[model samples]
Target chain A: MHRFANPARFLRIAKPLTPALFWLGLLLTLIACIWGLFFTPTERLMGDTVKILFVHVPSAWLGMGGWTGIAIASIVQLVWRHPLAGVAARAIAVPGATFAAICLITGSIWGRPTWGTWWVWDGRLTSMLVLFFLYLGYIALSNASSEKGDTSRVAAVFGVIGAVNIPIINRSVVWWESQHQKASITLGGSSIDTAYLVPLFIAVVGFSLLFGALVLMRMRTALAEMRIEARMRRMAQG
Target chain B: MPHAPFIIASFAVTGVFMTWLIVSSYLSMRRAEASADALREQS
Candidate 1:
């Protein structure tokens, strides 16, 4: 862990890994999308709108998963003082927020025909919205701290604190009697039938790989920027 | 049973956002690397 904290060493690993992840993710997602859109049978109850599940569920999962990445990176920064941890946390924020926003929009679109309402204050929906806001707040806090030359500890702390919402977002439907359906898939088992389940899993894996690629790309950028800043400081001192 | 528009819209939005993120990140990485290289040359 500590050895890889060196930006040059990390870049050596990431440079080769990024394109492979990106291409693999793109191919898998393309295959899954086509499979879901055409081959899968429509739900008897919801009809073709059920196809929306492929993108929506993955976006929602990655949204929360992104923050979980941030929380872990935060822990690394705070406890181990890993130099690259803050960069990793910062790198994860934008894509995470984008996915969170996608989840909300897609969920709303799915809601309209199914629930007969475009928006609702249900536990699942509202908590996910809160998660989106948390992402925005973390981004703002991170930028501000960087500009002020403060240690990223503020943003790191916020990342850890904001992680409290993840479980709430996950279990919201379970905890409250809401219009939103309870978890279709759980650790113990999934209620989804095989017809729908296969492609959905493929989509999730594809999207997760894409998400990983995006984070690594951004982390590389962050590392480069950090190196540039350190070089500038050294020149100034000399 | 004609919810095709909603499904299309969801996929379209996701594709657009994900593409934008990938392209933007790639461009930023290029710029950062360029600047860092220039700095290294100067030093």
Candidate 2:
């Protein structure tokens, strides 16, 4: 794990795998969307509104998963001083924010149909919204610091702090009054029928892989940019 | 399927925007990589 902490080694490993991940993710996402749109049975209660899960649930999960990765990378950067960890942490911030915002927006859209309201202060909905704000705050605070070390440390603290909300987001439906429904699918067991479950799983995998590819590409660019900045500073001093 | 059109529209919009985000980000990163390489060459 730490062996790949070196940017050069990480890049070499990721470069070969990037194309494969991108194509596989693209194929899977397309298949999942087609399966959901055409194959899955419409809900007895919500009718076609059920199909929203094909996109919303996976994007929500990816949003959480991406932030979890950033938090872990931040930890590695702070504790082990892994050189590429900061790059990875920085790389994931924007995508994670985008996914989280998408999750909230889609949820609201789905809500307007299913619950007859576009906004709610329910536990799950509110917490998920908070998570999006947290992502924005983390990105903003990181950029606020002029010193690189200060920026990384500030972001890392925010990253770790924000992570505590993930479990809360997951369990919010269980613990409190929620307009949001309980997860049809769970890690331990899924309540969703196989008809809906299969495509949902495919979407999850597709989104995860796509997120991985994006992170890798962004990290590589960040690493390169940092190197260039360092060289310029050295030249200026000389 | 009371509101199939609305749901489908939302999904299509999200899909198109997401695809754009991914492509634009990729292109931007590639451009940055090129710039970095050029900078390295000059040094």
Candidate 3:
């Protein structure tokens, strides 16, 4: 982790890695999309509505996963003073928020047909909504603190604090009565049939790769901006 | 095929946001890279 603290070294590795992840992820996602949409049979109960799961589940995982990345990066920033920690955390905010919003919107879209409404104030839904708002606030705070170069303590603190919502989001459906379904894929075993589960799993991996690529891209950009600022500062000083 | 609208809408919105995030981030990277390069030449 500390090895990547040097922006030049990070850029060297990321330049090649970014497009690799992006293109591969896009290809896999397209494959999964077609497989899920055209080839599979609809669920007996939900019918075509279950098709939304391809996008919905992936978005949900990444929405939560993105924040997890933020919190981890924030921890690194606070603890080791890792130079790229703040950059990585900031890079995560927009994409993370985008996924969170996607989850909410897609879930709402799924809900309208299956559950007879667009949304509910159940624990799972409400906490996921909070996670989304937390992402928004993190973005705003981190953006305001960008000029600091390597440190954004306030936003880092917020990132860590916001992580409290993740567990709440995960456990909400189980803990409280809600229209949201409980975890079909738990460590014990998956309730999802093999036909849908395969592509769904692929979709998750592909989307995760896309998320990683986006983070790398944004981190590279942040590094570049930092370079520009540093150059300008040195020029003025000289 | 009954809930086609919801299914299509879900994927469509997901695609839209994914595209937007990618393009916007790429553009910013390009712009920042260009500026940094220009400054390097000046220095």
Candidate 4:
């Protein structure tokens, strides 16, 4: 990780890696979604509504996964004072929020068909909604702090604190009796059938790759902006 | 495809959101890098 501490070295790898991840992710998404939507057999219980699983599951994973990233980045920023940590955390905010929203919207779409309703006050759903709102708050607060030029610590603290929601989100279904199904994929084995599981795994990987690429690109932009600011300050002194 | 609209809407929304997010991030990177270059030359 420290090897990438140098901006130029980071950019050298990121520039080439960005397009590779994007295109590969696009290909994988197309393949997995196509397979999941058209090739897989209709689920016995859920019928066609199960088709939403591909997108919904991946979106949900990334939604929570993104926050996990922010929390780690926040810790790095606070403890190691890694210069790019805040930038990476800030870069993660928008994509994280977007995925969280996608998860909710897609989940709601799936729920309407299966559960005969558009919304629920259930534990899994509500905790996810909380995460979405947390991302929104983090984005706003992070932006406000960065704009003022010296409040990254506040945002870092928020990232660290907000992580308390993640475990709740994960355990919500188990702790509370909700319409939401318990975990299908667990340490023992997946309850999901092989036909559905294969494509679902692919979709998760595809979405994750795309998420990684977006973060890299955003981090690049932040570094560039930092450069512009530094250069402008130097010119002003002259 | 019993509930075609629901499934379609799910895919559609995902497509739109991911496309917008990826495109905007790429464009911002391009713009920021360009600005950095221009500023570097000025200095």
**Candidate 4 lDDT, A53-73, residue by residue in tens:** 999999999999999999999
**Per-model chain A TM:** 0.97, 0.96, 0.97, 0.97
DockQ of 3: 0.80
Docking class of 2: medium
Predicted candidate 1 versus true structure: per-residue lDDT over A1-238, tens digit per residue: 9999988898999999999999999998999999999999979888889999999999999999999999999999999989889899999999999999999999999998899898999999999999999999999999985562364789999999999999999889989999899999999999998998999999999999999999999998988888899899999999
Q: Where is model 3 chain A poorest over a 10-residue stretch in terms of lDDT?
A: A142-151
Give the poorly placed runs of model 1, Cα more than 4 Å off: A147-151
Tens-digit lDDT track of model 3 for A93-149: 999999999999999999998899999999989999999999989887877754574
Give the whole-model CA lDDT for all candidates, comma-separated: 0.93, 0.84, 0.92, 0.93
Candidates' TM-scores?
0.97, 0.95, 0.97, 0.97
State the lDDT at A112 in candidate 3: 90
lDDT of 2 by residue, A37-144 (tens): 889888898888888888888889988888898889989988998888887888899889888877887888888888999899989988888888888998898778
- Comparing to the true complex, what docking class would candidate 1 get? medium
Q: Give the distance in Å from residue A130's predicted Cα in candidate 4 to where it truly belongs.
A: 0.3
TM-score for candidate 1 (chain B): 0.86
Where does candidate 3 clash, by residue pair? none
Q: Which should have the higher lDDT, number 1 or number 3?
A: 1
Give the native contact fraction of candidate 3.
Answer: 0.94
Residue A83, candidate 2: Cα error in Å is 1.3
DockQ of each: 0.79, 0.62, 0.80, 0.79
Q: Which stretches of candidate 2 lie over 4 Å from their true place?
A: none
- Backbone collisions counted per model: 0, 0, 0, 0
